[model samples]
Target: MVKGAFDGVTVLDFTQGVAGPHASMLLALHGADVIKIEPPEGDWGRALGELKGDHCAHSIAFNRGKRSIALDLKSPDGIAVVKKLAAKADVVMESFRPGVIGRLGFGYEDLKKINPKVVYCSISGFGQTGPYSKRPTVDGLIQAFSGMMVMNKMPDGTPWRQGMIAVDVTTGLYTFQALAPAIMRQFRFGEGCYIDSSLMRAAAAYQGAKLMEWVFSKGNPPVLYMPAGSYKTANGYIMLSAMRPHHFRLLFELIGREDIANDPDLQSHDNRIRNAAKIIKALNETMPQKTTEEWIEILQPKDVFCERVNNYTDYLQHPHVKATGAVDWIEQDGMGALPVANIPGLPRASEHPPQQYAPHIGENGPEILRELSYSAADIDAMLSRGGVRAPAPAVKAAD
Candidate 1:
């Protein structure tokens, strides 16, 4: 079997919720040995959606191919165990509020003393320094603060948050991109660096183009083009991107609006924008004459840029998606069968099996402790004292 790019790497995941876990999970999917350290109740994500034995949709989705160790971080023994693991880890990722990890004695500065070459990444809502650094943050809050709500405002002028946790997910990807290079630096120059990534920064970066445009236009989008919006078809909506003059002309002609296409008053870009309401009213009345598919069929052949607005089900069952093997089906032990998206350019399904599902809290404690050279008695003692937790011992069949 071929090895993954991160096959020999080990990641110590001290994150919960979306951002930090997502980054570590991406590393795990690429073959990193990621040990997820969770609180005694497990990652809070385990309770996010429907739950089954410390597993939930969010947890399972972001925590595949990793081990879980539930420890009482306040306990001296628990702190020692984490430090021991950090001493040998290749990367450390945490999403604690600023200064919390430092108070816990596992901050990047503290861990660097134990493992100088460890690539440490810290993820938060805001960064480590700033008046708002300590403020609690989630995707919605960041979206509102980052002007994303304004960008997604409804036609009636109501600001709206994006349906998904865009900031958290994007921060995770940004964290991975930052840490991956730091890991390479360790191999190339034996140098490890601390990374500070935040949802605020990621959210801002995600809307970089829009933010710059807002500044340039003094808060309103510039009227540079026409026929660049979504229109309601007979059954559904279709978004059209006819920014160029030729494309706009083609769109008007295809829609059977020859008068609008030939109108001298609407020929210039500024005139078209100034008369947008008239064009929009015409489209709103005419577009609904044909269904979304009918519009796609007609417009696609005419080299017009238009596509039906598809929901998740439509996207999942799309022929092109299946043809590209974009998702994989797997049966997790406790979570049942689920569809997992595959990373592009990687193996569709690696040798990692269903047993690689998200683990119960402290499911791998004993095994991890054993790897740390702890004796059975010590492991039992830690479990007894509530310093560590492991799955119940297997039952033996009576003869």
Candidate 2:
């Protein structure tokens, strides 16, 4: 097999929760040596998964390609251990409240003196420099701040949070983008960089459409052309929109109602908005006659750009998804390989599999300290100083 891109890089992951760990996971997936440093209690993600296993499914997704070591930063020996690792590490990823790491004496300033080539990344909800930086928040808080909570309206007209930790997960991806370049620059430019990866910043990017409209249009969206949502088509529904004047024409053409296309009353963007109700009525009646499949085939081919609003299961099972290999399968503990969606440019082989189990809290302490070149006496002193912890054995996987 071919070697992966980041085969020799070493990343010391000090992040907890989703955002930071996710960044480490990406680095690990592509073949970096990601050593996840956790408190004696382990990452909270290890517990969030519904199952009682050491590896929570959520944690597994982001931690597959890493090793684990437990250290207590508050302890002098633990601080010494991590500082020693920092001296040798190329990248250090942490997701802590603003001043926490600095107080622990492992901040970028503190680490850079020991290792000038170390790229230190901080992932947090607000950012490292904001007044709210010290205030702890979760994905829900980020969604509310980013206005994503109301972007999608439920059938009940209630605003709801994004279904998953969209904020933390995407923020992780953003961190990777920031970290990788800095790592390269450290080698070429000879100085590492400090990065602040904020969930709010990442989530704000998701509002690009609304932001673009507000910027260019100089006010609220043409609620009149809010691309008035979904319409009924024969057989199944289609996500019909009359955003542009031309799309209206396409809608008319697709429905075999050319009269509306030429009508002066229905020609302009604003006019379509005024009459969206009537036009939608006609489209609703016409669309349901054909199956969603039929219209998707015929209209999309005609550049009408129509689609069925499929349920999650239906979308997952859709032939196009399978044909494109958009989803792949993974092995579960009790179950065999189960379907998992392949992310964009997702690894086919080089990527590590999802973690099957989290290391027992502090499970690898002795081994990790050994790799750090700590002598047995030194390691025991740290352990004695409350710098290290060793957990009980993990549930071994089947052979």
Candidate 3:
């Protein structure tokens, strides 16, 4: 049995929703003992989309491979339990609004006193010290504020957010990247650090090149390449990129528009951009004559970078996807079977069964309490007093 990279690490996770939980989930998948501290009701992420028992798609996707304990932060007993956990944790993460965790006595500064080698990470919307730091925000709000909506404008020029929680997921990845290096530094130098991660910063970093282009071009960046866009076909759509001059020429020739390919005015990329309307109009008139699959078959052999616009179902069932083992089907507890995409650098879900199970709310409370040296009576008292919560015993089927 080979150990994972973080096999000896312990993480105390007090974050909810996508970003923070996503980072902790990655840690758990890497064999860290991640203790997810949630409110009695559960992490609010579990309420995203349709709920299935104590889990939702978003929650399960971002919270697998972690033990859970539901606790009321306002209660003294709950705070004590967290403090005890913090003392032994190699890492601590929270996603509270600025100053809230500090007031609760679990901020980086507070925890550093008890455990100097703890790498504490705080994730927020606007970061720790800004005028908008306290302003409540979610993935959509960050998308709007960070110019992602503007960047991803519809053809009609309407600013629209992405269909998915792009900013939140990206923030989670950035947070994990930050934490990994900090943990390495701690192990090497015996010094702890604080990570202030935010959706705003992560979103900005994600669009760094675009921002630079905006500034350099004074908000009028030139088109990257000519004849690079999605065209409607008879059946559906095909996105093609004839970025290089030779590719552009080849595309026109393949479409049986030899006159357009030979046109001197549209030979260069700059001229093509200037006469984009002409090129687009020609493509629009011709593309509808063929189905997306037909166009793919015709253009792919000619070295055109083209792909059929696929929905989720199409992508999931793609032959290449299956051949590459890109997704693994797992029986998620309470949620039944689901297709889990394998992370590029991590082991597949089938290789690590424990990492594939997402815990229900407080699902491991009694076991965690026992590890913390709490007696059965004390654990029962905490549960009875509403300071802690554990899942109800499962009812057996009639024999």
Candidate 4:
């Protein structure tokens, strides 16, 4: 078997939701042993979207490549078990409110005492020392707080949150980026570091260019390219980008608007932006005359950048997506067959079967306890006392 980049690293993950779990999942994918510590019930993420037994799409998506062990943090045995794990962990991640993890005695200061070289990461909606740090927040809240909703305004000019958990997922990517460098630093210099990541900051970073544009333009940033936006076709919508003057000319000429294409007032990009209303009106009047596919056939041949606005199904079924192996179908246990998109720069799911498995609540509890050198009786005692939880024994069907 090939060794992974983080083959020998061990991550103690105490994060339940998308952001923290996403970062830990990336670590797991890179060949780290990520031990997910859940509550007695399960990670709250497990209930996100529609539940499939103990897992949901969000949970399955972000928690793959990790072992789960449910523990009651309030219990003495649970705290003891965590401390033991912390002492040996290369990285520790938590997504609790600012002081909640500290109060539970698993804070960076607490863990660093036992393992000076542990890379501790804390994920939250806001930074640790912010005025709004203690305020409860979710992906949508962060989207609203970070100006993403405003930036993603609807056609009717109403601020709108994205259809997906954009902020949470972005936060996870940022968190992983931070962790990778911190781990590298730790490997080089025998030192540990605390990573304070938050959805608010990550969302802002994701819109960094937009924020700068807003500041530079004093809130009225000029349109990027006049003839670049979604337009309704006879049957469906098509998004086009006529970024260059030639492309704009081609688009207009193809759409029977050669007059607009050749107008001196719209030759330069800045001039086009100034006359956006005129260009947009022409497109609106003409684009809907043809179907999205017809428009693609016409515009594409002229070197105009345009594509049919595709939904998930359309994207999944696209010939280019299949030819490139962009998505792989995997038979996820309990979830039936699932289409898992291939992450860039990583091996396909078929190449790493173990990394494709997302654990059920406390699915690896007994095995994890055994590795901690706990006797079978001790494991049972903890389970009975609610300090730990493992999957219930499967009842055999009688023949």
Q: Using lDDT as the measure, which candidate wins?
A: 3
Top TM-score prediction, candidate number = 3
Selected candidate, larger TM-score, 3 vs 4? 3
Per-residue lDDT value at 166 in model 3: 98
Window of ten residues with lowest summed lDDT in model 2 = 349-358
Residue by residue across 109-141, what tens digits does model 1's lDDT show?
999998999999999999999999999988999
Poorest 10 consecutive residues of model 3 by lDDT? 390-399
Task: Score every model by TM-score.
Answer: 0.93, 0.83, 0.97, 0.96
- Evaluate model 2: give its TM-score: 0.83
Candidates 2 and 4: which is better by TM-score? 4
Give the per-residue lDDT digits (tens) of candidate 3, residues 1-399.
Answer: 457789989999999999999999999888899999998888999889987677778988999999999999989789989989999999999999999999998988899999999999999999999799999999999999998898898878898999899999999999999999999999999989999999999999999999999999998777788788999999999998988999999999998988888998998889999988888888999999999989988999989889999998999999999999899888876667888999988988888766888888888988999999999999999999888985664411111
Question: In model 3, where do residues sit more than 4 Å from their true spots?
Answer: 393-399
- lDDT by residue (184-218, candidate 2, tens digit) is 78878898888988998888876778777767887
Error of 1 at 64 (Å): 1.5
lDDT against the true structure, per candidate, is: 0.85, 0.75, 0.91, 0.90
